[model samples]
Target: MNVRNFSVRRSVVATVAAVTALALAACSGGGSDADADKPSGPVTVKVWAWYPSFQKIVDLYNSTHTDIKIEWTNAGAGQDEYTKLQTALKAGKGAPDVVMLEFQELPTYQLTKHLVDMGKYGANDLKGQYVDWAWKQVSTGDKVYAIPVDAGPMAMLYREDLFKQYGLTIPKTWDEYKAQAEKLKTASAGKAFMTDFGGNDGGFMTGLMWQAGSKPYSYDTANPSNIGISVNDAGAKQVMTYWEGMVNSGLADTKAYGTTDFYNGLGSGKYVTYLAAGWGPGYLASVAKTTAGKWRAAPLPQWTAGGNAQGDWGGSSFAVTDQAKNPEAATKVAMEIYGAKNTDAWKIGIDEAYLFPTATPVLESDAFLKKKYDFFGGQTVNDVFVPAYKAILPFSWSPFNSYNFNQLTTGINGAIEKKTSWTAALDTAQANVTQYATQQGFKVQ
Candidate 1:
């Protein structure tokens, strides 16, 4: 479920260098004490994001809307951004007018009361224009908090050339996938793995759990006190058990994905396929350029054959803060960027940023739907994801998602390193999560 990161390992690592000790600082309890800006002219809005080339879209919006100006900053990506923003929110200082958070992080922010309820500002009118699942993600219960911008429905990205060479059948179910893993392990003479294990990727494992019908975590945001978490539940146990076997048997590559070593494996025929998110193809193509035209994407293997039920990986949304000086104009800027299909910003978002669309207008647009890529052998890749986005079975994110993922990195990696039972790791993780939730004032069951 990780975005292919688009060379972000190099970039985000650099960001961490500059934003060093943010989490440590949070632990030590520090903040800038800077208040949110209240501008006198044109309602200057400070926006924070790490998306490269997003200024192009911002520029377009600024050109047409002279009454409001966007002051944008690339505040690093993922954890760094979240750390800085959360620190600001907690400190009541330097919070931007608008912020971008991953869908998973939305609930975490909401739990802390950091986001504004956009529904009161008339977000419901924007319904039917965005994907239902995505719109649902930014909301807790009946209150909307953010505008859905992009989605990352799960799909399988495979090396067609490698599959053909190995005489492997495209797997349609988990059983077939295991058989293919064994077949590929034998056929490649231990030179290639069927796919990567990536035990460090909690998002990927969470997506797998979603696909397996696992309700691992839930918290009632309305109350913020009632929480339910079951990482060792039967469904999750089934998924982890399967992967533990594959990894133990040496059928799956045990390397973390989106790394130089992993890409080297791909180039060297070490991994033939990857279960990646919708944003995967572009990121993979950017980094794995030499492997161009060798890959193809398909629906993820289902637990039940032919079932289209699925899970989402990574995606982001735009939220106006409760401290905005011009919430209406901020909404306008958001409307300009992602209001409808074929807008300049949305076009650039898909073409330049390579974010897969969950907005209806773009989803139904002929150009977007029929867009073909030479990287995919001229296949219209969006055609493959449209259904995946639609098929995503809805799931609720616990308010402790970032916390859960951060802990999971350690727990899951330990499982892989020790070659121990993932079920036991889940038990530990579940217990820790419950403890953390309770510490955060949630009533855990």
Candidate 2:
């Protein structure tokens, strides 16, 4: 799965103005269950996913289950599938029975009440199969929204060699991180920078806010019209100020995410560290092997020196839509494909796909965790991830997170470009999102 793209934009449907067709389709109740025209026979399970790898997993399922036929389609990755799914859901015309959605994006489906409650279908029995944090991503208020597939818990991936070369120590807190950012630049004779501002990634920026103890957004079931948006809240502002200082100090490069320079910098040692997730190490290793044996993982630097909090960057799950005709079979396909605890399919999803698994058993599998690599000096990658995963702090994902991310990236990135304070950027983001929430029929405070 495209980690950078997935991490950059957490989740969302396309703008409603562009998807006005859904409003018209919803007028007719938009076929919430599978085809009003579907002929009665062996239920054909229609599944839509972005990754081609999923087709193999689906084939594995079809080989065994004769009752339901799994007709899987590689529906293009990321936003393309979501945009179409949203349109289909809105028009009540064309939607798959089983679909893959990022755990963060599950709230987008939930906000529209488009998801089937898998709990009613007895998803509880398989609850033990996944980490609680992963399960929570697929559920809200005791209602099961989907099945956990894969995950990415946030941590720091730094260049161990660079740290030693520059006489810098690993930062254990944000303040120390700032000091080291400046020190590293000076020590490296202006050749290497400490870290990037992670511009273009409001989700990662928001994760930073989460690390600093700020809940910038939330969705309340009772008040759907007006959601809670707090980008410029005191806590968030404080953290933004801290980052603003680093950017001003000329130590943190804000224009890093999605750029060619950023990727190249990883190999050149121009960039020292990054806040990454479970799937990050492999992706980094694949991209920048010149730094092989030089990189190591550590928990994200804390706001308080002794803090152990962590968060997710990218992860997704399988949701059986309310539109499914065969909820049980659909749910089974979802579970069986993701892994029924230590199943070969689960192993494939983790080891083969490099999904950064959320399946508890797969996560703890000796084969999965014990695999050492020359990438991090022959250390088991999981040694960094397991502790990072366990320290994951539960946080909120707003239905409007897609919009939230878009606006924040613009706001913060703009500030970094113009060399202004992040407080102003936070204000800009807050205003844009607040206006958007109001326009979307949500009451915003």
Candidate 3:
């Protein structure tokens, strides 16, 4: 999803340094070993995480174990995290003993052999606990590279009051969604419309493509050489065209809203609809303090008239690095944090901070599904997204993913800004993706 443009700001540098210092201090402490049979020597395992909540999990691990202490380092945002990890791997020295990887980037890391094969450390024993799709992302050629920590199941967030005010029906198809957007724009006179088109983020495009049964690359396990490319495929073109039309018709705002602006825009009623995942409502609730009870959840508008395909936008996995001194202990700690029993705790944390859980049990829990989110007009938000978890198609992502997607998005956005034809823009995007993939040594068919 144009991962190259995603980055953590420089302001977080101080926070990262402080966290790293705390971790280093913990490493210095050689407390009573939890596993007396195992080696009691102090082992400091460096871990890289992009979010603050993971620090809590690290603390939990430290409290439970004495021999192995984890050093938590903030790796910035998704793209920044990958860049730093790549640099560390190349340098062969400062890389963390554990790295938090996004699902989209798992294949990239696996393909480049940047990550350790977890199966070597008994990861297969724990494979049964995770969902199939989640597990598939971290696997390559029978080698399980990582353990999934979270999943982002797509759903729709809308302004309930605005829908009622405009007398607009909840859309069931993309065409209906577009027509509603037009009506909403006309009704509100440009002050309110459908949603903010995140021109800079290709995540929407990716989700749409997956829902259309396409992937950036498809590799047949039976034949490793058979890699399939869906970059310029019909489904991709249709999705891009849909976005282009939205931008051109004045129903969508083409402003490049960063993370903060995105949440703020929803809170301030700058946008009436948000095509998002289960975590979106929680995120909006956290920031939209004043707009409580004004929002609601709905199903994503289908591309085909009655299609039920679903797709994910963002998710993450945890992997123990080969450099770790206590790899077994580290894997155990990761499993404990992501296990099903902890789903309630994870859901509570998500409710407090918008951190979605990947554990299947948590998503299906009645407590999670029944909770009435005041921000969403007391709608049962979880019910809308849980089903999408199983409906998403599995795809193999390439290491050069960010490069190709970012280039395609830039070209498409440029065309939109210049009032170029949608088809022409898509043709340019296809050519750009093809060239980029070829340059990266991926066979673009």
Candidate 4:
């Protein structure tokens, strides 16, 4: 998972704007000239991935394999790499054999038909090896476009000491959560908030909406040029209205996450709970050192009591691009780069990079689930997250996610600033995005 910059996985849709039908006309014959020569030796797969300390994984793969060699390059993170990839895709050359893409960004690339169908290379056989929701993110029906890597399953991190002091129990549902917010406010005399309603992060809010059973955007591989935009759908409005009330009631803080003020809020205990992803523990530990041992992890408050719905915030996958001269070699690299069998890669990802695994073997491993964190007072937070990961409902993303996120950020920020209603914001985003998609030659429904 890319660091959720508070919204660690910041993405941009400027590439979508550049991807006119005219540009795609030139993309039909795209393939890298780098692999024009068929070497007698091992096929060298050019890979573009932004994983930190990724060289360790590459070195391990290269050393242990004789038929394939990985030439790893950190092309840049998120939008930077995406912009470059889009440019290469348009030019019909220069793209790598494999590239790392965030789940939300996959459809945008897939819409251009630049991603290889990994199912042809036996990716479907490994379907049962990964978490279900993660596999769904990278595949649409029978076409597998990428291999799942790490995921950011949603969970709640709260101040255990604060909950105890306020005489509040962990909330089992959204209603209980709201009631607890009221109790926390009364007990603390308005000194602390239940949590901050971060209005500036579209990705974060998307996760919340996902938990509420919102499917704001949908694109079917069957109808590649058609999209479904329902940003103001009933489920989404339900979530928006809930948060709007919280902010209006002064029960939740209205600070943009990852800001200095927001960090201060967590550090000073101005916010009693953090609705965070699997990566939250490490981030919280770094920002709120003094609050160590005061925090504990728990399942996110369900929309319905005892419900199994879950959402994902940040996660990425390795995709084999269509430019690969050797699709089989590239597919092999994509699958095993972070495959379950690669213990060394898993160690680098989990222990060193603090990545939350998406592989079932890693997610269900006793070692991973039992690894205690000193920050959470020796609590095995994965115990909370692993189930959440497994329980996530399959989500679909639009091809214009970057644009969608931008509009959402604008709408949400406007709502928070008293210029609009949350539902109205969604309505505006719906109309604008629909118009934009139609203008881009898509049939927006």
Candidate achieving the largest TM-score: 4
lDDT by candidate, in order shown: 0.74, 0.73, 0.67, 0.84
TM-score of 2: 0.90
Q: Tens digits of per-residue lDDT for model 3 on 238-354?
A: 777888888878888777645677767777887888887656776667667788888888888898798888887777778765455566666765566556676544754566546
| Model 1 misplacement above 4 A | 1-41
lDDT-based ranking: 4, 1, 2, 3
The RMSD (Cα, Å) of candidate 1 is 4.7
Error of 1 at 2 (Å): 4.6
lDDT of 1 by residue, 190-268 (tens): 8889988777666778888888888887655676657788877888888888888888898888787767888887766
Clash count (model 4, backbone only): 4
Query: Model 3: runs farther than 4 Å from truth?
Result: 1-43, 219-227, 259-264, 343-348, 443-445
| Candidate 3 vs 4: which has more TM-score | 4
Worst 10 residues of 1 by lDDT: 9-18
Range of the 10 consecutive residues with the lowest summed lDDT in candidate 4: 20-29
**Clash statistics: count for each candidate:** 2, 8, 1, 4
Top candidate (lDDT): 4
Query: Candidate 4 has which clashing residue pairs, if any?
Result: 3-8, 4-7, 4-8, 5-8
- Which model is ahead, 2 or 4, in terms of lDDT? 4
Clashing pairs in 3: 295-376
Candidate 2 lDDT over 366-388, as tens digits, reads: 87779786788987878778777
